[model samples]
Target: MASGLDDVIAAETTLSDVDGANGILVIRGRSLDDLARTARYEDVLALLLGNFLGKETPLIQSELGVARAAVFTHLAAVDATILALTPIEALRALMARLADGEDKAVALQLIAAPAVFTAGLLRLRQGLQPVAPDAGLGHAADMLRMLTGETPNVAQVRALDTYLVTVSDHGLNASTFAARVVASTRAGLTSAVLAALGALKGPLHGGAPGPVLDMLDAIGEGDNAEAWLGAELAGGGRLMGFGHRIYRVRDPRADALKAALAELKLAGQTPGERLALAEATEVAALKLLRLKKPDRRLETNVEFYTALLLEALGLPREAFTCVFAAGRVGGWVAHAREQIDHGRLIRPQSRYIGPAAA
Candidate 1:
């Protein structure tokens, strides 16, 4: 048995190819850079859905808007129980209310759930009324509007679009694997998505990005980056955003999101010093990591820049993973469809070692 399933090939997928050694991620036939730099969130979602929905891009975009509106009705369903949870927790609670199905509408609703529920929960927690979905606006734009109750600038929309596109899919990650596993069991899209969300809630997966901001906040203003980072390393604490499981080199998504922050900064009036401090801290963390683990490649990963980029886009750190789910839902849907349509139940045999199975 391969411990932790290292180099395991459990399934074959034509969805996204992750070339870890080269640090390249290709979704379908397109490079991540091509999609992240040019495509809108709807465009990428449409692309991922592809023949699964058998709808054209414009139609897919239109249906996504309708899906957003459909899921928005559930915002009224939120009660004190939901409000008491964090944004992601509240999102999970609301999503649990959705029915499981394998239809296009079900897939699209799963895609729209995180955005509607997370934003609604955030607003409700702040004593603000939930913003209804605008079918006229794009997914990322509409999401931002719901988040801040203001019209986001072009740059802000573009950055979020880039984020959504960049993360739309990658080869079977932890959450994606969970999604595929549940889907393989014929549990339907909503259940698959819930499974994925459960996996993402773990700290080693989608939960790390929000903590990156905490690290940056504690290290404030570049000057103390070294001492702070040094103390963290000396205490044997794992740096939040420096290393990735798949990419031995720098994560490509890190570059994509870092560039997103740069583009947003160029077009918007943000506090540049915060970006500078984050940059300095990243450099310090990477340098210290190398000194500590000379035999291992501890390079910058997506979480570091994801925090900075989302902060620039006016998102609270607590809502970061939920926003990430808003993007990865497309992938989860695609993978679920693939597993249900082309694959089988995901069950692996374990060697009996404890008391020789009695």
Candidate 2:
């Protein structure tokens, strides 16, 4: 058995594709670079949801946005339970609160899950009371407001959107697979999303970016990047943000997000030379890796820019995974709805090898 299920095809899908050799990610029919910059999160959801929900209606974006606002006010029910628990527990509790029904109104639960969960985690971790969402603001704007208790400037909002759209979906990765597995059990959408959240909280998934920032901090300023990376590699430490399971070339989302972060540079922003240092370090490491591990194809991935952009956005290290969830909710909803419409029970058989014939 491939314990990690490497190179395994577990399901037939009509979703995104990860073409590492060609360095392309096609979601639905559009390229990731095309959509991350142009399409709004709701627009992509509408595209992914497709015929799953028959006769598409208008105001989905507005509806989800408004629904997201409404859900924020109600997180108090779970706030007390999970504040003392781990983030995954908090996230699960939040998902339960949102998933209490199957009526069409449950669509609002899709919008509410990420915002409420992320905001609540931030507040609980910071020893502050969670603020309710502001209905007057857009979803992205409202999330920022809820997290910080203050409105962000326009550049910040755009940067957030860019990051969100970039990560919104990426084929059937680990969390997506976990989500599908939960959904296959005929679980409610909230349960599936919570499963995905638990899977994602692991360091091997979206949680890796938070430590990437820590690595940068440990490296201090630009002067130490190369030597620090070298010593870490010699000790067999995997550089946090550099490589990916897919995208053997370069992550398209990385380019889009890095551009967004560059555009949003604020006044007296201390000019984080981290990006430049990272680029140089990546190049040096890639050259060295090619010489060392000649058979393995290692390339830069989305976490590189994800760490940079979120850091630029003033998000704390602990909030990185939650922020990732906030961006990925659209993809989760779209995928769950698509599976319900076009897919069957996701039952996969495994050949058991341990203690055989016992």
Top of the candidates by TM-score: 1
Which stretches of model 1 miss by more than 4 angstroms?
A: none
Model 2, 1-358: lDDT tens digits are 6668878887667768888878888888889888877766656666666454323434555666667766765666754557777665576666666744323457566655677668767776888888776665666677788888888887777778778778888888888888777776667677778778888888888788888778877887666777787788788888877767876777788788877867766533325576676666666667667766678777777887788888877777777887888878767766766666667888788787689575
Could you tally the backbone clashes for each prediction?
Answer: 0, 0
The all-Cα superposition gives candidate 2 an RMSD in Å to the true structure of: 2.6
lDDT of 1: 0.88
- Where does candidate 2 clash, by residue pair? none
Q: What is the TM-score of each candidate against the true structure?
A: 0.97, 0.90
Measure candidate 1: CA RMSD: 1.2
lDDT over C-alpha atoms for residue 15 of model 1:
90
Give the per-residue lDDT of model 1 (tens digit) for 1-358. 6677879998899899999999999987889888888999878776777887654767777788899999999899888988888778788889988989999989989988888888888889889999999987888989999988999889888998999998889888999999999999997899999999988888889999988889888887798999999998899888889988899999999999988888877886457898899889988988888888899999999999998898887788988999999999999999999999899899988887666544
- List per-prediction Cα lDDT, in the order shown: 0.88, 0.73
